[model samples]
Target chain A: MTGRDRKLTRFLRIAAFSIGMIFVLLGVLRGEHLEVFAKAVRICLECIGIG
Target chain B: MSGMHRDRVETKDRPGLHERFRLLIQLASAALVNGYAAGFAGCKIFTGTSKMVCLPVLNCYSCPGALGACPIGSLQAVEGGAKHNISFYVLGTLMLFGVLFGRLICGFLCPFGLVQDLLGRIPARKLHVPEKIDKPLRYLKYVILAVLVILLPMLAVNQFGIAPPYFCKYICPAGTLEGGIPHLLMNESLRKTAGALWNWKLGILILVILGSVFVPRFFCRYLCPLGAFYSLFNRFSLFRMDLDKSKCVDCKSCENVCPMAVKVTEHINSPECIRCGKCKAVCPVDAISSRFETDMLTRNVAVKKVD
Candidate 1:
C-alpha cells in the first residue's frame, strides 16, 4: 500500500514476468518434440486396462 | 447423541466418489504415457498428430509413440547444442501456464507429484523436517538449475570440443527416469549397452522418488529445475492467493492444510507456494482466495453471525 511496498511488489511482478517468459518460450520451442513422451503415455495406459 | 454422529458420518463420506475421480485422473494420466510406449513397441515419434500438450507433470518421455516431449527433456535438448540458445516458443508456453496456474500443477496436474502423493499413502509413519531444516533446504532446486541445468551443459566439451546436456546426464532425475528408463527397459539395444552412467542416473531417480514420499515434493521443492522456473511466477501468476487481513481470523487453518508448508500469513506469495487452492479450500474464515488477475477480486467474504 505504501510507496516502498508498491515498489517491492512491482519488482516482484517484473521478476515473475521475466521468469514466466522463459518457461513459456521453452515449452513452445519443444512442444513438438514430445512424440516420444506421448507414446510412452499410451503404453502406460494400455498396461493399466485403460485405452 | 448417536444421531449427531450419524450425520457427521453422512457428511464426511463425500456422498459418492470425488476422491475416486481424482485418483482415476491421476492414474489415467500416468497410464497414458506408459501406454503410448507399449503401442509403438519402442520409443518413436508420432508424425500424424498436430496438437500436443506439454503435460503439466513429469512423464516417462522414452515411452514409444509419445505425441509430445517432456518439458524438462525438451529444455535440455535446446540447451544441449553448441548454439546454447533456449527455445523461446517453449519458454513462452511454460511461462504462460506458470503465470496462470503457479504450482497448482504440482497438486492437481503433475503425474509424478500424484505418484508421490499415492506412495505417501502407505501407513509408514512420515518423517517430518522441522521448519529450521525445511526452509533453507528448499533452495536445492535452484542449485540444480544453476549447476545441473545451466552450468554443466554450458561447460561441457563435445565431439569437436563443444557442449552437451549435463543436466540430463548428471542431475535430472526426471530425464533419467522419464526419458531414459522406459526406453532403456523396453529397447534391447539400449539395455545391452547401458553403462555405469546409466546406473548413476537410476540411483539418483530412486533417491528422488523415495525422498519425495518422505518429504512433500522433495524434488519439486529442491531439485526440479522446471518447478524452480514456475516458482518464480508464484506471486504474479494469474492464479494466486489473495489475503484480506480484515477478516483473516489468523487461526492458521490454511497453513495446516498446505502440503508445501507455506505460512499463509507470513508470506502469501512465497516462490515455494504452489497456489494449489488447498488453503482456500480449508480456510474456516474464507479469507484466503485465489482470485484471478482480471476478476474484480471477487473475494469470498465471511458471513458468519456473531453476538
Candidate 2:
C-alpha cells in the first residue's frame, strides 16, 4: 500500500478501537455489570424447560 | 480394494503441532468455564459475582458447573427482562470480541465446537451438503439471530409481561447438552417434572449430535446464531487471514484442508472462516497467514491510490 494509504489504515484502526472502548465504557456505566451478575447467579428454570 | 480406492484414500494430514496445541487450548478453556468442582452432586451453579462476565462460547448458563454466563443467554435475559431493555454490555462485549478476533472464538474457545470436532473424528462416511443447498442454509442462522434471539425477545411478551428468550427456550442444543442433561441427572425433582418440552429439546439435541457425526460442525454451519453474529464482523475484524498473492501458486492446498469449507484462495477472509489457521498450516508455499492486516486500505489502494 502507498504511504498515505498505510497512514489511513492506521488511523482507522485507532478509530475502531476508540469507538469500541467507548461502547464498553458506556455499558459499564449503564450498570450492565451488575445486571449480568444478577441474571447469571440464578439458573433460569425456563431455559432448561422446567418452566 | 482397487486403483480408485487407492487414489481416493489420500493420506489424511495428521494434526500438526499447531492443531494439537489449538485443541489443547480449547479443552483447557472448556474445562475452565465448566467449573472444576468434584462430582455433579451440587445442583448449584457458581454464583460468584464474577459470573457477571460473559464468555464468548455457547456454553449454557444453567450448566451446574459454569463459572461464567453464556453471552447468548445473558443477552436474552436482558432483552426478556420485564423492563425489556437492550443490553449494551452484552452487545459491546460481543462487538469487542467480534471486531478483535472475529470467529476465532468459535474455532478455539466454544465448548460445543470442540464437541462437534470430536464427534466428526469418529470413523464414518462423512457427508457434505451440496453448496447450492449449503449456501442457502447458512442464512438460516442469521434468521435465527434476527428473529428468535433479537426480534422475538424484543417484541413478543407472554401474559406475565415478560418476553422469553425464544432461541434458548425453543432451540439451542448446547443448552440441552451442557445444562439440561446434567441438571436432570443430578436433580431427581427435575426428572420427575420433565415434560414434552424437555423431551422435544432432548430430541433436538440428539439429532444435532448425530448430525455432527456425519457433517462436521452441522450446528455451526447451519444453526449457531452466535457464529452468525460473529461472522458479520469478520470482514472488518483486526485478526484476519491474508493470502500473499506474490507467493501463491494457486495450488489450492489451503482450500483442501479447510474444515469450514471456505474458498480459501478466493476469499481467504471470508466470514465463514473460523480462523483456525488450518489453511495456513496446510499451505504448501506458505502463502497464507493469519494476523492483523490493513486489508481494507490495501484493497482501496489497489483501486485508487491515495495521494
Candidate 3:
C-alpha cells in the first residue's frame, strides 16, 4: 500500500476507536448498563424455553 | 525450492503450534466465562455483580453458569422493554470489541463457536456448499441481525408495550443448547411446560449440531448475527491479517484450510475471515501474518512489504 493509503487507514482506525469510546461513555451516563444488569440477573424464562 | 515441494512440506505440518495455541485459548475463554459451577449444580443462573458486564461473544445470558450478559440478548432486552429504546451500552460494547478484535472473538473466545469447532472434528464426510447458494446464504445472518435482533424487538410490541426477544425466543440455537436443554434437564417442572416453541428451538439446535458436523463453522458462516456484527469492523479493526505478496507463490494452501471460505489470496482481510490462524499455520512461505495496527505504525515499515 502507498503512504497515503496507510495514513488513511490509520486515521479511520483511530476515528472508529474514538467513536466507540464516546458511545460507551454516553451509554454509561444514560445508565443503560443498569438496565442490562437488571435483565441479565434474572433467569430469562423465554431464553430457556419456559415462556 | 519450488512452490509445489514447499506446499507438500507445509501440508505435512498443517495445523501446527498455531492451531494448538488457538485451541488452548478457545478452551480457556469458554471455561473462564462460564465459571459459576454452583449455578449449574443448583439449576440457577448467575445473579452476581459480574452479570452487569457484556461478553463479546454469543454466549446465552440465561445459561446457568454464565457470569456475563450476552450482547445480543441485552440489546434485545433493552430494545423490547416498555420504553422500547435502543441500548447504547450493548451497542457500544459490541463496537469496542469489534474494533479491537473483529471476528477473532468468533475464532477464539465464543463458547458456542467452540462447540461448533469441536463438532467439526467428527470423522465424517464434509459437505461443500456450492458458491451459487453459499454466497447468498452468508447474508442470512445479517438479515437475522437486522430483523430478529434489531427490527422485531423495536417495532413488534404486545398490549403491555413489551416485546419478546425475537432472536432468543425464536432462533438462537446457542440458547437452546446452553440454557434451554440444561434447565429442562435440571428442572422437571420446566420440562413439563415444554411446548411447540421449545420443540421448535430444540429442532433448530439439532440442525445446527448436525450442520456443524458436516460443515465447519456453519453457524458463524451462515447464522450468527454476532459474527455478522463483528465482521463490519474487520477491515478497520486493530487486529489485521497481512499477506506478503513478494513471498506468495499462489500455492492456495491457505484457502484450502480456511473454515470460513475466505479468499485469503485475493482479500487477506476479508470480513468473512475469523482469523483462526489456520491460513497462517499452513502457509508454506510464511507469507500470511497477523499484527495489530499499532504494531504496524511503530515498526520499521521499510522491512515489511505487504499487500
Against the true structure, whose DockQ is highest?
3
TM-score per prediction, in order, is 0.74, 0.87, 0.93
For all candidates in order, the CA lDDT equals 0.60, 0.80, 0.88
lDDT of 1 at B107: 61
DockQ values of all predictions:
0.18, 0.44, 0.67
lDDT of 3 by residue, B69-185 (tens): 999999999889886378877888888899889889999999999999999999999898999999999999999999999998998998877899999998899999989988999
Residue A14 deviation, candidate 3, in Å?
2.0
Docking class of 2: acceptable
Rank candidates, lDDT, best first.
Answer: 3, 2, 1
Error of 3 at B234 (Å): 0.5
- Candidate 3 chain B: worst 10 consecutive residues by lDDT? B294-303
Q: How accurate is candidate 3 locally (lDDT)?
A: 0.88
Q: Assess the local accuracy of residue B171 in candidate 2 as a C-alpha lDDT between 0 and 100.
A: 90
True-structure lDDT of candidate 1: 0.60
How far in Å is the alpha carbon of B90 misplaced in model 3?
0.7
Model 2 residue B163 lDDT? 85
Instruction: List candidate 3 stretches off by more than 4 Å.
Output: B1-14, B295-303
Top-lDDT structure, candidate number: 3
